[model samples]
Target: MQVTFETPDQPDVHALIAELDAYLYSLYPPENVYALDIASLLAPNVEFAVARDAGGSAIGCAAVVVTPEYGEIKRMYVRPTARGQGLARKLISALEEKARAQGCSVFMLETGPTMQEALALYERMGYKHRGAFGDYPEDPLSVFMQKVVA
Candidate 1:
């Protein structure tokens, strides 16, 4: 497996994003969802990462949207067949390294309450629970988390 920074417009990456979007929408109402779209992922402030298998098929993806103050993780997802291989962890590590390179002091994210595995992963990765940041308002369904990028 390999991970690299790339534009989110690639066909495989688009398909994966669609799948992720569907899954998240199913888990949470539209007002409660906070995922970045392809255009948003391609914006100047955001950096997208794609993980590909040996065959070069896009198997997972994540993005970091950097601002002057901090970086926010977005659109993190692994193909169902690709889970349990540490791809999510690897993708996040890559994002954190990129954020550090860009001088971002903190890394943050918001996941849904139903995503227990994701919450556990974020906790294991040193992200602590926090209040909503950026444009997100306080919502009962949102689980906000953050970690210093030191």
Candidate 2:
């Protein structure tokens, strides 16, 4: 597997994002969903990356919206077939490294409680529960977390 920085508008990336969007919307109300759209991902403040398999097929993707205060994780997803192989961790680590390079030591993310595995992963990765940051309104369905990189 190879992970590299890439634009989010590619065909395969769009497919992956579409799948992730569908899955999230299915699980949560539309108002509670906060995944960034293509335009948002393409904005100057966002950095996106894609993970490809040995065959060069896009298997996963992640992004971070960088700010002076913190880097907010967004659009993190791996195809169901690609789960359990550590791709998610790799993608996140890459994003953190990029954020650190840009002078950010804090990382924040908002996920849903229904995603037990994701919440567990974030906890294991050293992110502690926190209140909603940025423009996100306080919502019962949202679980926010933060980590300060050393």
Query: Largest lDDT belongs to which candidate?
Result: 2
* Candidate 1 lDDT by residue in tens digits, 84-136: 99999999999999888989979999999899999999999999999989888
Cα-based lDDT for every prediction: 0.93, 0.95
Model 2 whole-model lDDT (C-alpha atoms): 0.95
Show where candidate 2 strays beyond 4 Å.
none
- Encode model 2's per-residue lDDT on 1-150: one tens digit a residue: 999999999999999999999999999999999989999999998989899999999999999999989999999999999999999999999999998999999999999999999998888889999998989888999999999988
What TM-score does each of the candidates earn? 0.98, 0.98
TM-score for candidate 2: 0.98
Could you tell me the lDDT of residue 56 within candidate 1? 97
Question: In candidate 2, how many Å is residue 4 off?
Answer: 0.3
| Model 1 alpha-carbon miss at residue 47, Å | 0.8
Minimum summed lDDT over a 10-residue window in model 2 is located at: 117-126
